[model samples]
Target chain A: MKIIVCVKQTLDTNASIEIKDGAIHAPGSARIMNPYDEFAVEEAVRIKENQPDTDITLITLGGENSRDILKTGLAMGADRAVHIIDSDLDDFDGLAIARKLYEVIKDREFDLVLCGRQAVDQDRAQVGPALSVLLDIPAITVVTKIDFSEDYSRVVATRQIEGGAERIESPLPLLATCQKGLNTPRLPSLKGIMAARKKEVVEITDLPNTAGSVENDAKLRILELSLPPQRKSAIMLEGQPLDMAKELAQALREKEKVL
Target chain B: MTDKSSIFVWIECQGEQIKPVSLEALHCGLQLSESSGQKVCAVLFCGSKVPDLSPLSDFAPHSLKVFSHGRWQDHNSQAVSSTFFKMIQEQSPRLILLPASNHGKELGALLSGLAQAPLASDCIEVECLGENDFKVKRPIYSGKAYASLALEGAGLHIITLRPNVFRGESGSATVLPEADINTTEPESLSLIVREVIKEAGKIDVTEARVVVSGGLGMQGPENFGLLEDLASVLGGTVGASRPVVDNGWRDYSNQVGQTGRSVSPDLYIACGISGAVQHIAGMSGSKCIVAINKDPNAAIFSVAQYGIVGDALEIVPLLTAEFKKILNG
Candidate 1:
């Protein structure tokens, strides 16, 4: 089985975001592989562990820095990597990116494709389902549990929904976007890190030009990026715990009326 | 097809009634229609038996479009997407608004892909720039930053509005036209839903008016009983920080953080939460926040409207008792 795992490099969640000159400042921000995509890579590696013949390939689309994330995926045990490098590509929306991804990997022979539920940067969660549509395959999003049939012809997946879960079944050549609680992703060992240095990374500089449709035009344009408005200073209530509790209760009833 | 412009809203049904988020989207759609001089159209996908559409009459949409397919009763993304896709092809609406629910997000992405339309997801605000143009505000970088996006093109503009952000409005009851029902099965569907396991009778934290959230300071799952008591008194829901969920102290559904659900409740009480950026991103949008922790320097106090520097274990029960006294009286 050949598996393609989509990975993206994102600003570390711990890093404080800063907007400068009408755009998000990327410099000085620590960039790591999107936290959710790590789960996808981990799941793919586990599948390779179970089926020794399974081949895992990591694919990414970003600027020059994206190669680092692909290399990190390689360190986590993907067999190879593909980097579609174009700074202009960053301006495209999720659907265009999905179309480009489909254009790149449509002819490749793969039994399964995996992606993160959503990128922390965009928080769109659109590419995986859009990619599945472009590829004309079945997709299940926010999947937490996946089980393959003994013959490897079908898969049963448990996906997270609002306030509940749903068990779904689909045939092979399916796509699933990973969510948290799927599995604990393992860090790359030193040996694996050293081996990743020699892994192959195929880079493409330009995307295929099938671009006359209205969808090919960038629909969503970023006008400005700004920090969220800060809240007013908190009123620290002083007194004994019981007294404070009474005061808070009175405030909720009298002021906030939320009680 | 007529050249008349219309704004379409996807009215999501939960059992017999409309979901609050979908109603909120309808409100947003109505606002957009008023601003752009377009008509408001509500689309409801149903099963064999149609839901009670009388309640929607209070919102006074110009028309209601019902697409009934047996498979739609269950939450099938393929069926919903195909139905909406067919409708979009038939009626080229100027804009499409959907709730930012799980099904909505999936269907939005699927329809965008199938129709090659552009989508703005989880938008907090939407503005009609002109006839076929829109400007939307959405939180990015885990709510730390807000990005203003402009959608301009000849094709359809799609947006998934976040819940609780838009205020729902009701006008004088106007009898709406009979829903135009279309019963068409999707051509091909490879996925099958085997079973659905729902968490019964639990107030979702995202929709809760009040939320009592615990964190690492919660110590263990047993300590959550105090929070449950407090939540019950406040008629609210219980939530936990990501660390608590990661430690297996609570179900993932109760988690509030960057990876989990973003909530904008009326009142949010944080107990022992240290307020990491990830956790803060989820609840900072609350209208009023009260933080209770032993540590005076806990970051949660920064965004909280009120702070009590004390032991949560001791204070939560006291607050619950006090609230019960005041509310019951």
Candidate 2:
């Protein structure tokens, strides 16, 4: 089976963020591979582990900083890596991204394409599904579990539903956006890291629009981005914590109107 | 003409009722249709029956179409795909808006594949750019930056709207002309839902207005009670970091961050949390942020408006007590 895992480098979630002059300031913070994408890479590599000849390619559309994320994938044992380098493409929307990616993977033969459900930062959560549409391939989204039959021609995937989960089966050459808890992504081992240095890491640029639709436009614009308002420190009372709690509860139930 | 009529918004139904996020999508859909001067419609599948459409009266949709499943009691991608395929063929709505929920995401992706339409997901905002073109904006880089996009292609444009970004507008309950409540049985039936182990007795962090979360600095599971007390005092829910959840100090459902649930509460208070980027991605959109940590340089304080650099065990109790006095009095 040939598998492709889409990975993205994301901002460190815990960085102390500052909005200065209408720009977000997240300096000196460490960046990491999107945790969700780790699951995608792990799953792809796991399938490769089960089938020794499986060719796993990790692809990312990002800047130099994204290398950290792709390296982690290589360290996790992906066979090859591809980085589409374009500085002007910093803010490509999911539609634009899907278009760019579809161009690269359209002719490639693959049994499965895996992506993290959503990148943590923007959380738009649209690329995998949109890619499926662009590719005209079936997609199993938010898949919590996936199992292939002996022939590796069909897949039975379990996905989260409204209150429960649903199991669906689809043919190969499909897309699946992996959700967390599907499998525990393994950590990069020392041997794997040394081997990753010798593996294939291809760099491509100026990939043309393969979809042939200049339909590249966005419907939403951020008028302004600002930090949320600060909260006032709580004022401590003198009574017993439990009694004060009851009074607080009554106030919430009565004055606040939840009751 | 703007091709304004025959707009369809996929209403994600939860059992017999529609999800609130779906209503938010309708609110967004109405705006898009109005800007482009088009009529709007709400599409659903036949089940128990469509719930109260009262919440969506604002957009004043020109139609409500219930595509039935004949006898199937659940939602299948192929069944929905075939139904939507038929609806699009009939109505030829220029734009189809879907909620970016798990189900909506799955079905929308699958439907777009079947129908061979353009699909966009997790869109935060949308505006009509030109004739049959829409500009969409969404946060990228873990909410650290933003991106703008344009969708221009063939006849049908399928897009998913992020929840919370479009607050549901309470519309006057008005009914509209109905479409076919049709049904179809899919061919793929390889598995069945054996049991649904619901994550019970816990508030959904994503939907909660106020959230108070803890992290490794919380010490241990026993120390979480103080945070819970604070949450109860504020009539809010409790959240935890990945470590806390992994250490069995909290349930995975209560975990908030990149690997967990993404939330946009009105207020998010971090007690003893160091504020990892993974954790912040989930709650950074909160309207208000308060960080209480012993270390003055804890990463959370960088984004926090008010910082209380002290022991959370000591401070959370006092903070809870203070809220009791102010909110109660």
Candidate 3:
């Protein structure tokens, strides 16, 4: 089975972003492989582990910062990586990014494609579904559990809805956005990291639409950025814990109107 | 088919009832209609029987488009989008508004891909710029910052409004026309839903008006009873930070943060959780936040409107008791 796992390097969820002078700022913060994407990569590797003949190719679209995530995918046991180097990708919306990926993977052969349900940074769960539409394939989104038939021609996937879980069956050449509760991702061991350095990492930058010094091809344009109003410090009622609790209740009822 | 001046609101129904988020999105569409003279249209893909749409009468959408097929009886967004895309191509409505629910977001993406439309997801504010242009304000990089996006040009635009925000009230009841869409499920509808396991009666964290969340400071799963008690009295649901969820102390559903569900409750009470930026990103959009922790410098305090320094095990119970007495009266 040939599988494709889409990965994205996202703003570390732990990093603080600031808006200074109408621009986003996150000084000295880290960028990590989107945490949800790890589950996708891990699931791919586990399938490879169970079926040694299975080959996993990790594909990512981003600027230079994204290559690091592809390397991480390699350390997580993907066989090879494809890095579509485009600086303008960060400015592109989900559909545009999916179009870029489609440009690369449209002709490739794969039985399954997996990715995170949504990148936490942007919090838009659009790419996987859009990619499925662009690729003209079936997509079972927010899949919590997955099982493949012995022949690898069919799949049974579980996804969570508002009040229930639904098990769906689909054929091969399917796309799924993996959700949490799937499996715990393994940390990269020392040997795997050393071996990953020798693994293949291909870089491609010749896409005509996304070439250098080009305008953002996104349909939506960002006009301005501002921070949500800052919250003032709470009035610390410094008597007894019981009294403070009473005061808090009074505040909720009278001042906050929450009660 | 809806006209070019129609603002289509995709309404999601489960069996017979409309999701609250979908109704909220309709209210948003109605509000947009008021200013731009755009007609409000509701779209639903349902089973054999449609839900009680009289509730939608209060919102007074101009038209309700119903598309039904046996395949839509189950949860299949691809089939649903496949049908909706045809309408998009025919009508080319001015705008499409959806609730930022998991299903709504995915459907928005698929339709946008099919039509090459611009989509602003999780938007808190969407305004008409006149002449088929729109301006939308949504949080980006999580809730750390907000981006105002301008959807210009003559092409159709889509906005998935965030729930619990965009306060719009229902208007007088009006005659709602039912547009019949006679369409069969495409042969591409290959996925089949075999079973559905319901987790009954528990309010999802995203849908909760109030959220009482715990973190590492709770010590163990045993201490979660304190939070559960507090949540029960507050009429809220329980949420947890990553550390507790990672520790196997809580189910992943209760987890809130990056990688977990993003929520924007009216009130969020953080107990014992140190505010990691990841955790804060999921919940900072909440209207009011109260943080209780032993450490005065816990990061969660920064995003909170109120802060109290004390042992969560003790403070949580006291607050629950206080709320019970105050609210009961």
Candidate 4:
């Protein structure tokens, strides 16, 4: 079985993200793999463990820093990596990103694809489904459980809904967006970490055989980045736990009228 | 059929009731219509049978449309997308607004790609800039920062409103003309839903009006009963932070924050949860937040509307008792 897993890098920011010159700047934050993508890679690796011959290819689009996630995927036991890097690609809308991924993977042979249900940075939840649309393949988003056929020709997956879960049955060459409950992502083993350094990673500067300009075709454009409107200052309750609880309950009913 | 330039709002329903976020999307549609002068069209999705339509009268959309099929007993969507594609081609709506929900966001994004339409998913605010143009706000970087997106020009546009952000309102009683739109055949779709698995009587944290959440401070899974008791007293649901969920102290469904569900409830009480940026990303939109953690410097307090510095193991029960006395008395 062949698999493709899409990963993204995100900023681990706290409450203080500053917007400087129309862009969000988190001064002291560290870059981390999009948490959802961790689940996707974990699932893909689990598949490879069950079927030793399975090949897991990790794909990510970003600047030079994006390679960190790719390296992380390698350490997590993926077989190879594809780095589609462009300085400006980081800010493109979901449709444009989907098109780029389509260009890179269109020729690849794969029976399955996986991605985090949504990227933590943009929180768009678009790429996986949009990529499926571009690839003309079926996509099951927010999938938490998956089972593959012995012949590798079909799959059954469970996905979350508003109030319930749906079990879907689909043929091979399908795309699934991984959700949190899918699996607990494993930390890279010491041996796996060392082996990752030697893994093969193909790098691409620009999308070859360009279909159309991603910028011109972008449906949505970012106007600016700014802090969300702040909530009013909190009222710190006083006294013992019992007194505080009574005051809070009263505040809920009388002050907020929410109860 | 409505005019070609209407703003179509996909009203998502489960069984007989409309999802709350769908109503919020309709509310967003009405607000957009007031500024754009476009009619608001409510499109209904039905299960094996068409649910009653009278409930929609309260929010009275300008026009109504329905698509029904047996396969839609759950969220079977291949047929649904085809039907949506057909409708878009024939009617050519100016804009489509769907709830940024599990099903709705995916469907909206798929349509965006198929149609190559510009889309902004999970937008908290939509302001009409001018004719056929708009500015939308969506939280990015896990709710730490918001991106203002612009959708301009004549091409079709789609926006998915975040759950619980927009307030629902009663629209004019316009006595809408209802129509049955065509549905794509389930046989042609590539997938099938074998069954729907749902925990009986479980309230989705995203859909709940109140949420009582726990984190690492709860110590262990066994202690979550304290949050459950508080949640029950408040008539809310239980939620958990990533640490607790990762530790297997709680199910992923109960997890809130980046990687889990983003919830914006009327009231959110965080217990033993030292707020992480990812957790705040999922819940900063909550109307009222109360944080109870031993450390006053826990990040959760900065976003909370009320803060109580104490051990959650003890504070939670006291709060539950107080709520019980207030509510039960």
Candidate 5:
């Protein structure tokens, strides 16, 4: 079995994000693999543990600093890493990014492709599904659990919906975007880190010129970016627990009218 | 694709009723149609037996198209997107609106890729600018900022609207004439649904009118029972911050944060929550917020309309008992 996992480098979730020059600037923010993508990498590694013949490859498309995440993926047991370095890639939208990813691995023989449900930064949750469409494969998003059939020909995936779970079975060569609760992503062990240092990191510079490709052009253009309006300070209710509860209840009924 | 005109809204139906978010999308479509002077078309996918379409008549859509198949019982993005692709090829509507549910978001992305259309996901506002253009406002940077985007293209413009933000309205109860119904079975479905397990009769945090959420301050998993009690008393739902969920104190579905469910309930009560930016991103849209934490400087207080600097373990039971007495008496 062969699996391809998509990983991205994103700002740490705990970083205090600030707005500077109409864009987000988290000063001294440490870059880590997307928290959700770690689940994808872990799922791939677990599959390899069960199926000894399974090969896991990590792919990422970004600038120079992106390889850090790929290296992290390699340390987490991915067999190899593919880095598509394009300095001009920062301006691409989700759809264009999916198209570029499709261009890179459309011909590869893989039974499954996995990605995080959504990146923390953009929160679009579009890339995996769009890439699946481009590759003409079925996609299940927000998947929490996955199991392979006895023959490894089909996989049963449990996906999270609004208030429930849906169990879907798909044949091989499907795409699944993983969500939380899928598994506890393991930290890279000392031995794994040592092995990763010796592994190969393949860098590719052959990207199709997206200028002539109509489908590769960005569909949505950002006209302006601004921070959300600051909220007013909370009106602190001072009193005993009973009195505070009474006042809160009264406020809910009289002022907020939510009760 | 010759000068597209009509606005098509995807109406998600389970059994005989339309989903609330889909109704909101329908209302959005109607509003856009008023400016575009285009017909508002409602697209529904139903199971083997076609459910009653009369429930949607109150909204007074110009036309209703039903896609009935056996496999439509569950959400199959591949099958649904295929149907939508065929519809787009046939009608070529200028605009497409869908609810920003899990299925809607996935289908919107799939259709956008298949149709090569510009898509705005989880949009809070959308306006149909004339001449094949639309302006949309959506949260970016994990709700830290809003990006005003313009979709200008020759293809369909797709927008998935966030639920609870768009107001739904019903027009005169006039039945819409049924347009062409497609009964084609999805071709070559690679995915199959094995089973669907749902938490029966429990209100989802996303759709709940009120939410009572806890965080690391809740101390442990058993402490969430206090939140559940309060939620039940208030006829609301129980939620948890990412840390609580990460600590295995609660299910991921109950997590309210940037990476979890984004909720905009009428009232949100944060108990013992420190209010990380990630968590605030999800519930900041609530109409009113109340925070109860021992720390006065908790970030959650900034967005909270009401605050009580106290221990959640002590205050939650008292608040729950008070509400019970007030309501019961």
Candidate 6:
């Protein structure tokens, strides 16, 4: 079995992201492989653990810094890493990005393709399913658990539903999106990190035409970004605290329709 | 007035009733259509008898088209996508819009492939940049940030707009030409939905604006009643963290996180919840977040505008009573 996981590099959640001069800036914080993508990498590695002959490869497209993300994947036990570096690639939308990634794996034969449900940065949640479309494969998003048949020809997976869970079964040559519950992502061991330095981190610069006819780049650029408005604590109130709270509550219910 | 350049709104239906989001989509479609001087039409797909199209008459458009396939009684993405693709190509609508729900996401992505167009999924806003050009805004960085996008190249733009960001209006019902567009269904080979596991809930979180979510600090299932009370007071919904769901304090459907349902409520109140990254991914887009946790350093507080370090059980009742008074007054 062969698996390809799409990983993206993004700013850590703790970083104070701000837009200055129309560019989002992440100061000082080190970039990490998207946490969601970690689930995808873990699932792919787990598949190989079960099937000794399995090979897991990490594929990503970004600038040179993306190599760090690819290295992280390599440290997590992926067989190899492929990075399509293009400084001009930042403007591509979800469908275009999906097409480029799909083109990379279209000719090669792979049993499964795994991706995080959505990158924490983009939040589009389109690439995985869109890639499934371009590759002409079946895909289930937000998969919690996936099990293969004894023959490894079919899979039984659990999908997250609105309030509960739904079980789905799909055959091989499928795209499964990973959410958080599938498996615990393992930390890279000392030996693994050392070995990642020697792993092949091939960079492809030639970009394939995304087959899109409209050349609409980002048109709605942010003029300025600012923090949200501050909300003040109006009154803590006195006497029993409960009575004042109730009075304030009554005033809110009566005056404000939000309740 | 019928225009050569038209905007098509994909109306989703369950049996004979139209989904609420579809109406919301129509409202957006109307704005785009009117602004671009293009005729706006509602395209509805149904398995059997065409649903009540008249209920949607209040959302008047240039026209209405109903597509039917008897076999579509079952939920099949390929069948629906293909049907929509063929109809869209035949009509040559300049732009196509759908709701950014599960079905819409699947259908929009698939049709984008079939039609060879760029798709901006889960967008909250769309603006006409120029003649037939659009700039779409979508949330990025989970709900922590947003990005504005513009699709260039294809004349027929395909997109799935997020709900709640746009409001639905009761446009004066206008009648226009109706067209029936249906195409052949694709054969399914490998995947089949054996059975549907349905979750029980009065309101879906995706459709609710007010949500009361609990985290691990709630202790156990018995304490969830406090959340329910607040939710009832607000006429809102209830959600839980993965831990709470795992503890059986709330149903899995009520779970909000990366692995759970993503929600964009107007007011999200987190009680005794330590905001984990995964949990924040689901509700970070909420308009306002109120965090009630004993630990002031909880990650949830970073994103919460209002934070109260107190017992959830103590705060919830007071909050609920306060809300009830506000609402009643």
Best-performing candidate as measured by lDDT = 1
Q: lDDT score, residue A51, model 5?
A: 95
Roughly what TM-score does model 3 have, to 2 decimal places?
0.94
Estimate, for each residue in B1-329, the C-alpha lDDT of model 3 and write its tens digit. 46877998998877667778888888888888888888988998877666677767767688888777666666577777877877876787878899887678878988877777778899988888875678999887777778888988766788898878865566666666765654465555678778877777777888888899999999999999998888889888899998899899998888888767778998899999999877888899998888888999888888887788898888889999999998899
TM-score of chain B of each: 0.94, 0.85, 0.94, 0.94, 0.91, 0.86
Q: Write the per-residue lDDT of candidate 5 for residues B189-295, one digit (tens) a residue.
A: 77777787878777888778889999999999998999999999988999999889888899999999888888878889999999888899888888899999999
For all predictions, the C-alpha RMSD in Å is 1.9, 5.1, 2.9, 2.4, 2.5, 3.8
Top of the candidates by TM-score: 1
Ranking by DockQ: 1, 5, 4, 3, 6, 2
- Residue-by-residue lDDT tens digits, candidate 4, A181-241: 8988999999998999999999999686453332222257778788868878788998988
Model 3 Cα displacement at B169 (Å)? 3.0
Clashing pairs in 4: A219-B118
Query: Best by DockQ, which number?
Result: 1
Q: Which sections of candidate 5 miss by over 4 Å?
A: A90-92, A209-218, B1-3, B52-55, B169-175, B321-329
Stretch of 10 with least lDDT, candidate 4 chain B: B179-188
Interface RMSD of 3: 3.8
Give the DockQ of candidate 2.
Answer: 0.22
Give lDDT tens digits, candidate 5, residues A1-259.
9999998888887776777776678899899899889999999999999999999889998899999998889999999998999877743278778878888778688999999998888888888998898888889999999999999999999998877889999988999999998998999999999999988888989888342132412267888877777789899999898899988988887788888
lDDT of 3: 0.83
Candidate 4: TM-score? 0.94
Model 1 C-alpha lDDT per residue in residues B186-275, reported as the tens digit of each score: 455778888888888678787788999999888899999999999988888899999999899999889987888888888999999999
Taking the candidates in order, what DockQ does each have? Answer: 0.69, 0.22, 0.54, 0.61, 0.63, 0.32
Q: If chain B of candidate 6 is superposed on the true chain B, what is its TM-score? A: 0.86
**In candidate 3, how many Å is residue B127 off?**
1.0
